[model samples]
Each structure stands twice: as structure tokens, then as C-alpha cells.
Target: MNRSNTTALTQPGAPMKVRNVSKRFGAFTALDDVSLDVAAGELVCLLGPSGCGKTTLLRCIAGLERQDSGVLYLGDRDVSDLAPQARDYGILFQSYALFPNLSVEANIAYGLAGSNRDVVRKRVGEMLDLVGLSGSEKKFPGQLSGGQQQRVALARALAPAPSLLLLDEPMSALDARVREHLCTELRQLQRQLGITTLMVTHNQDEAMLMADRIAVMNNGKVEQYATPQDIYDKPATPFVAEFVGQGNWLPFQRSSDSHANVGGMSMRLAAGAGQAASGRLFCRPEAISVNPLLHEENLFPARVREITFLGNRCRMSFELNQLPGHALTAEVGSQDLPRLGAQDIFVALPPESLQVFA
Candidate 1:
């Protein structure tokens, strides 16, 4: 949680801008002309798979690592060459990085080292309240749960009331259930306080759930940067489309900018799609309709290869007769399964639902 009702810890957020930044270590490139604009009070996630350079970019912004080239800005200030201690932002690492020997009070007050003792105590109390850990100030990191330790780290990061907040895999240490709850809480608090934040995460769900926008990275370069819905629905690259979520991909030859041929089956594509050439047609499983009556002409015979029930929903795996050997999955509500009892069915993949990448 990043919000605060106490004026002592609340401050207006500052925008962050990274302009044509690049970093490299030896022969390995870590960031490639990366650029991003994070508006004031917005949460942006640097999302990608492991070793994709998301962390490296975060480190460069935090001044933990020096960038080989390019500029960085926090609001109107150029902080490209500033060291970590001199930067006007607080970072929470994946490890929590809390001092095991220090009490929660001390850990959170570490950032206020030179402040008056009374002021430090008041700020620590305000931070503890902000994170919903008010009464646990005397507890050591080892004496608290994983989630609590994370809050202490968060409180420490926010204690300085920095205009920009940086998060590096902040919830990776918690169990799934706790991570989910804390994420929601943290997001609410971040919005409540209106703090600008940059988060680095490999988990797609976390990024999708909390980010106002996301920068999808791969191989030390930004693949696509946009809102989660835009990134998911209109991915700019094959890497972005494949990395963001589960989808059915089939090799096909484009008939034109608006049509594609998968095997002998004709599939409509988005207008102004890829060039007329061989490419892959992509569609998310959730976008596929199972035997819709309205799209009868586009429907194809399919056999249910498997059906997995997941509480409120079901994931149906299908083998389309027209595109055999291609993986096809459709996610439907559990209550809607009564109509899908038959092993055989007709499936529809609307033209507007597909992405063609040549």
C-alpha cells in the first residue's frame, strides 16, 4: 500500500521520463535505446520474462547500475548520472531487504536517519499505519510473516515521501493467496496517495492487474508499451502477443491484408493485417466462441480433446478438423458447459479476433 492520510508523509508525485537509454555489460547488452514516459501518479510496469532486461532497466533508473548511454529524468530534473542515494525515489526489492536485526520501527526509520528522534518516531508510526502494520513496529523481520516483512520494506521506501516509487518484484516472496490480496491493497493505496511508480515484474497477472500501462521488454529492448488492454488486444509484435497471455497460433498464408488461409480453411483477419504472405494467425482462447448460432458460416467442426474445470470456469481444448495438430483452447464459464456436453462441436474465430504476424 502506498497511500497516506498523514500530511507528514504525503506529497505530490513527479513524472518520470527515460529518454533513449542504453546499457551494456561486456559483450552482453542490457538495455537498447529504451525510452518511456511515466506521467505523474501513474503506475507503469516493466514486464517481461526472466533475463529479458526488465530488472536491468529498473536498476539503471534507480542508479543501482550505470547506463552506458542516454538520459533519465524525474520530473524536470535530469538524474541520469545521480547515484542511488542521491536519487529522489525509494525502491522496494524482491527480497524485501529488511534488516533482520532491526526492529520494524528501526527498519522503517532508517531512511530518516538524520531527522529528530521525535520526528522519526512520528513518521514511522504514520508509515506503519499506512501499511496496516501499526502495532508490529517492535517486531523483527524474522518474527513476522512474509507479507508483513514486505510491508516493512514498503513502509521504509515510502517513509521518505519520495515523489517517485520503484518496485522490483515486490510480491514474489509471498504465497499466491497473500500476493493477490496484498497486490489489490497496494494498488488501492497507490491510487489513494497518487504516487508515481515503476514496477518490474515477470508475472503477467500482476502487471495486468495493477499497471496503468506496461512496457513489455525482451532481449534488452522494449517490445511494446501501452495499457494492459491495448497490449493484450492489439499487441504490436509477435513477442508481445505471445508473451502476454495464452493464445492459439496457427501457421497460415495471408490471402490479403484482410484474409488468411489456415490449411484449407479460410479465416478473416483484422483490416489492414499483415502482408499477403506466409505468417501465423493468433487468437486468444477467451476470444474464441464455441458454436455460436450467429456466426454459422465461420464455424468449423471440432472435437473436444480435453476439458479442465477451474471452479467458476472451464478450459476446453479442441482439435479443429480444418487445422489439425494446432492447439485450440476456449475458456467458458462453468455454467455455460451444459451446451458443450457433446464431444463434437463447431467453433467460431471471428475475423476481428485474430492477429496476423508475418
Candidate 2:
């Protein structure tokens, strides 16, 4: 896909749809029929591990990488072949690619240089103030810190007031402290301006904090796209459940409509009612409870393998008797911390919190 034309920037509404976009590099396929809809004033984050095609999808949307097939629409206009500059999109690179030769003010004004000089100056000043860079506009990129440089980059992108703002790892360059501060500021600024934004990030915590919806991509495909709460509570696939957080994969065989044989013990599964061959059960760390005396109906006896202290919470890994060749990782509160390297610690696996995948 090559964008030979462009669109105007002063649009009235917000909505972007990427339909059946596919791209390939040599014989290796990069994107495989990826599609997503972003609403007006909504912040959607494309999240995945490295080499999962998140960045490739973003580049396709920006028209920097042409797709082998499929169409990208900005509102109702099809921009599958439109040029990047003509799409009227504001894109911020991960490295804060600011011009080292220009001052901060000049960098912001660069985007609007085609307009009248007075109008450009006014917009630059407004953008600099918006990004909290009031008086340092005279400083060049070399004279500013990483955080300041990133702010200048953001101001420059916003100076044109593009309809859709694209952020690719905007905070990845900042330190932990600065990343936290800027993430909050970015969220606040996007909301205040009601800009439709699409961000690509590999950090799960960053996606949960910054986006209204998250699209988890893997192997050039979207595994799941949902709200933060939904993604955390109910993941669609084993990959999603495992990638989103810490969990245990318990092996079990379907024995009947309502029950299954896990290891040697008969366990009931809400989903085993169907005649499925075999499946892996998902149990979150917080859902498994330590009960010496198995009181629950489907409770199992396990020995504590290891315990890791993670500041606010403690993680307990256990080995179940019925489940062979598998270990469970559980999350416990700091106050409810169990003894380290202890054995014969009985644990209960709650059914409501259990998710299964074949």
C-alpha cells in the first residue's frame, strides 16, 4: 500500500477503522488481516510482546508501510493509498525525533511553517504552554533532558492539531519516574483535548493505565480486544491469559459431561460439560487459597515449592498431587504470607475464578 494522495486535517468528528489490512516482508508475513475500530475521544492501545506486529500495524496505519492488501479509513475516507503528510495524522516517534538544529519553539513551529508567520508563532506558543514548556523554547534539543525533548516532540506533533494522534512508545524512552509522571500527563492532556488517539506499547501496565481499550496482538494476529477489567478477569485464549498476568496451566482430561479427571482425582469443570478431548485450566494467583484441611468440593492437596516476596504481595508456587508435571503460582497478601519452602500446604482451586482452554 502506497499513499499517493492526502486528506485535510480540519475534520469535525473522530472515528478510524482499519479493515482487512495485511502486509508482508519477503516471504515472512507481517500483518494478517488485522482490523480494529477506534471511536472518537477514545484512547486505544495496541499491546503485545516484541516481534508481535504491533509496530508494523501502527506503521501501516500511518502509511509509512504499505499493506499488501486491505483498506484503512479515517472516518469515511479510504486512506489505504494516501501519503503520510496528506492523512493529517500526528505521529510521535519513540525516540522523540526532534531536530537538533532547531530550537524548541522552532521545532514546534516546523509543522505549521506553511501557514502565516504570526499564526505559526501563536500556535507554537499555545502548544508549548500546553505541554508545560513555557520559557524554554529557545533551548535546542542538545540542551534539554530526555523528558524535555519528549515534551517538545509532543508539542511539535500537536501544533498542527491533527485529527488523529498516533503515539509509538512515547514514554519508553523516559526513566521509570519520568515515565510514570508523563503517562499521567499524557492521559490528562488527551482527555482535556478530546483527541482520538492510538498508541502502541509493549508494557502491559502502561496499556492498562493509558488506554480505554487494549488490543493484544500475537503472531501477527489479535488474540483479544477488550476493556482492562475484562482482559484481566476473562481472557479469551491461553496466550492472552498467560501474557496478561501470572497464572497456572493445570492439565486435565475430560471424563464426562460435567466432570473431568485431573491427574487421578475427579474434578468438576463448568466447561467440561461439552465433549472436549483435553484442556488446560487457568487459575490466577489470587484465586487459589491456602487451606490445610481441604474444605472445598474440588480442593486438592499441594506442597509449597517456593515463595517469592514482591514488595506489596507474595507469590507462592505449589505442586498439586492430582496434576502431574505442573506447578501453580498463587498471589497472597503481604500479611497473609506463608512460610517459605514449606511443604504439605493444602490449597483450594475455586471454580468461579477458573478459566479453561483446549
The candidate that achieves the highest TM-score relative to the unseen native structure: 1
lDDT of 2 by residue, 1-358 (tens): 1111112222333789988888899988889999999998789999999989999999999999999988998878888899999887888999988989999999888888679998888777777777777888799999998988988998888778778899999999889998988898888877777778999999998998999999999989999999988888889877888898778777778777667677887777665333456887677888887863337756877887888889998888778876645778888777776442357767777766766678
Instruction: For candidate 1, write residues 233-290 as lDDT tens digits.
Output: 9899999988999888888987766667788888777675556488787889998889
**Residue-level error in angstroms, candidate 1, position 253:** 1.9
Q: For candidate 2, what is the TM-score?
A: 0.91
**Top-lDDT candidate index:** 1
- Model 1 TM: 0.95
Model 1 regions lying over 4 Å from their true place:
1-8, 272-276
Estimated TM-score per prediction? Answer: 0.95, 0.91
How many angstroms is residue 302 displaced in model 2 relative to the true structure, after the best TM-score fit?
Answer: 1.3
Clashing residue pairs in candidate 1 are none
